[model samples]
Target: MMNKPYVIGIAGSSGSGKTFFLKSFLNHFKSDQVTLISQDDYYIPANTKTREENRLYNFDIPTSINRADFYKDIKQLFEGQTVFREEYTFNNPDLKPQMLEIKPAPILIVEGLFIFHYTEVNELLDYRIFLDADESVALDRRLRRDLIERGYDEEDVMYKWTNHVVPSYQEYLLPHKEECDLVIINNTDDPKVIDEAANKISVELHEKNSTLNII
Candidate 1:
């Protein structure tokens, strides 16, 4: 049997530096040898029924994603096979059916809030990382990103964070931290910590390869 590629999962609260860590790790590996699979891509289309119930559209929790497709894509990555998948654009309800012809890369990194939330994805990872950030810091980052990029105002952003993001983080994201192989606290601007964590993961992967034939 052929050796399966290493699978890594990076989970975190919003704006907790998972993206930075992922980029840092990618820098260490050749592009052909690494592929990034984000849970953000698995978000479900906004249902008017659900949106009306909540009064706000949040793509943060488990139900936000298309469970069937997400599980299937994770399975493909875990098997060292390729899958063409959809990219989830925030609040875009239409599915255009664009296919990205993905080849199986040797290192697969999956990052998101709910990657660890679901059992199928959790089981597929060889190693997992959880990002820990202070609530204030996370909120500040979210506010800035939403206001500048997503066209949300300060009052609405603050209200959304208080009501939706923070509570969801505690209830859904925090409890799953213990499931990860490592938990790193994210620094807002300075990514020294993110780089360190990525380096450590590289070292650990190398060590595992040398000792246990864990390719």
Candidate 2:
């Protein structure tokens, strides 16, 4: 049986390079040694909203997530139960969502914009990492991602950035920055810094959990 996992909570503002950092971090270990539970998958479906209304819907707030269910699943994982979740596709018509099977591992990573804000989820985190970036840099990355990947127009992206994302970051995420065990500032285009940070963190985690085999 797997021992109690060392849980890591990762949070950042929108476009703070979390996706990139996570990709780098996961590379250090075999897939079975680590499990990732992303808050994006726990978004409450807004099927009633029209296309135009969907653009106006504020998904940046903590209320937009099914926090109760998210916490329950995490608890189940801690109890050595495997969890299954439907992948959230951002309402993209062309993308087909998959069923994600998450098994308990020595290292569990919970990532989201509001993971730190949700009190129950925050309490489960053994370590916390916050990604930081300049406002202009994050805004630019958000614009490109929403426009190309999510099929959002420039106007809608800017509207959400100004009205929803920025406010939520200030109110929910930024306040918890100092509480994090590690803070990574990712402003430059080069991702080498992120890889280096991930390597260092992974080494320490492996040292703590000696059962985790390095790949």
Candidate 3:
């Protein structure tokens, strides 16, 4: 992979503090060196809307997204070519067709629940990370966020997590943690945790490149 961007994936069951870990990684590096792309940003609008309507969507599954769009974004980044990124709308929480400048940075962090399950997404990654978190805690956090942000009631949020998210995480996300460069069991609530991870990431990258040179 000549001139390829160094892609790192941070994954966990929803509410497993994947965001928290990503923020921590960001803290170590300056904005110019690190850019973040999330799988949530590439979701299929129709499926998300259906979930919003009948709440029948399996959000935790990798199939929740349109694979074609996901492949496009990753291919552009993987090839070290610049591309624009679309952000996800929380109000609608649907995928928006959008564009943002993406350049080759020192590190590119991609976080999501299903990052590994998607073969194309995984192929682009140089490093992968998974968070080990308790199911009850993850569910509670999901409930709170859904109620406050999405206007979903407690019952509705619980239904999706139990039916769609949890099962999918077990069946898909869990098995792929082994593919990552590191596995983070998120237990800290401190802001410093991110700093620590970022520093470690830098060191690991250095070590990897050094070994590659030795080859």
Candidate 4:
């Protein structure tokens, strides 16, 4: 039986279905038992740069994130303290964030492209998950997602994918998968894969609690 909350770090390349898997995983339990902390919420607060400058910003890199704040918030959750959830607008640059209160829970999920890229954040995770997807599939999914959710045009999406997103994944994100305890191959068509992953986590949590009780 562990005394602290169970922290799971889910990391993967863009368009690897990390969001899809997370949503599915969270569906297994009641909302009170779990909380999600997304690294996307910590992106360097709306900068004053121009549209082209913002477009040129390498969001895939570690520097694009305010890691210190992210670490502090997660650490607070670990200490059974409340944190304010930072709301990030996908395509809005000038909008200020709306921070909402987030209560601690038994299971805490930290998901992002660079969840494992920062040493401090990686050390705090009780379990790590890496989602793998084919480059072709990932590219297609990313293109579609950016177009609809992020309001990026085809040319811009392709440019960013080929230039920043893919390169950053190869340089920083992909190698960190070696540190993860579980590697999930995210096939967009398979719901069973998500279901199985959820069950594995549930069983592990139950077993850990049982052991802690015995101890």
RMSD of 3: 3.8
Model 1 segments more than 4 A misplaced: 47-55, 92-101, 209-215
Sliding window of 10 residues with minimal summed lDDT for model 3: 206-215
- What TM-score would every model get versus the actual structure? 0.84, 0.96, 0.82, 0.89
lDDT, ranked from best to worst: 2, 4, 1, 3
Model 2 RMSD to the real structure?
1.4
Write one digit per residue (lDDT tens) for candidate 2, span 122-195. Answer: 99999999998999999999988988898888999999999999999999999999999999999986899889
**Lowest-lDDT window of 10 residues in candidate 2?**
206-215
Candidate 3: where are CA atoms >4 Å away? 47-52, 90-99, 206-215
- What TM-score would you give candidate 4 relative to the actual structure? 0.89
Best of the two (3, 4) by TM-score: 4
The C-alpha RMSD of each candidate to the native structure, in angstroms, is 3.4, 1.4, 3.8, 3.0
> Where is model 2 more than 4 Å wrong at Cα?
211-215
List lDDT for all candidates, in order.
Answer: 0.74, 0.90, 0.70, 0.81
lDDT of 3 by residue, 97-202 (tens): 4566766565677777777887777877887788876777777777877888666678778788878877888898899878777776655456566557667877
Q: Output the better candidate (1/4) by TM-score.
A: 4
